[model samples]
Target: MTIKWEALLQVFGATLLVTVLVVTLFVIGIRALSDEKKGPAYASFAGCVAVVLYGLSLIVF
Candidate 1:
């Protein structure tokens, strides 16, 4: 069965999926880091934020 809003929902679904994946990866990454290696992880986090913003813009506009 197909719904009329499938196209809109596709964008929403992708955003939700990526959000979960990123959070899971970030949690694993943070846990795996040693005390001294956090700098790079934080940098990676900032990169993630950029990606999220871009995806958000796509879904929003």
Candidate 2:
């Protein structure tokens, strides 16, 4: 049986995108909790979670 490599590549790319999003949220959370420029950082962290979830929807379906 022959396996389709294109789907594999799509999955890999989506996975990488999700990783980047998670790391971005981590940085945002740290910066937000710190005593410097306390504003959009926290919101950004939340947004990151949403973004990752949205990305997963694409990968799963």
Candidate 3:
């Protein structure tokens, strides 16, 4: 069987991008909480959850 390098690279890039985005959002949320910024902290946590749910939906559906 032949491997599709292009497709593999595309998947790798997408995974890396998503991983960074999620981690960044989580970190921002933590920082916001520590700084006593409730609004931004909630928003950041929500963003992280949304991304995770989207990823799960992509895999499931």
Candidate 4:
């Protein structure tokens, strides 16, 4: 059987991008909370949760 190298690379790139995005959002949320900014902190956290839920949905459905 032949491996599809292009498809494998695409999946790897997408996974890497999502991981970075989630980490960045979490860091921003923490920093905002420490700086006494509640609004942005919550928003960032919500974004992270939304991404997680979306990923779960993709897996389930």
Give the per-residue lDDT digits (tens) of candidate 1, residues 1-61: 8676988899799879988878876775576475557776777677678778887898799
- Once model 3 is optimally superposed onto the true structure by TM-score, how far is the C-alpha of residue 33 displaced, in angstroms? 0.3
29 Cα displacement, candidate 3 (Å): 0.4
Evaluate model 3: give its lDDT. Answer: 0.97
Evaluate all candidate structures by whole-model CA lDDT and list the values in order: 0.76, 0.80, 0.97, 0.99
The per-residue C-alpha lDDT of model 2 at residue 47 equals 82
Candidate 3 lDDT over 14-57, as tens digits, reads: 99999999999999999999999999999999999999999999
Q: Give the lDDT ranking, best first.
A: 4, 3, 2, 1
After the best TM-score superposition of candidate 3, give how far the Cα of residue 35 lies from its true spot, in angstroms. Answer: 0.4
Clash pairs, model 3 backbone? none
Off by over 4 Å in 3: none
Q: What RMSD does each model have against the real structure?
A: 3.8, 2.7, 0.4, 0.4
For each predicted model, how many residue pairs clash, with residues at least 3 apart or on different chains?
A: 0, 0, 0, 0
Regions more than 4 Å wrong, model 4: none
Candidate 4 lDDT, 1-61, residue by residue in tens = 9999999999999999999999999999999999999999999999999999999999999
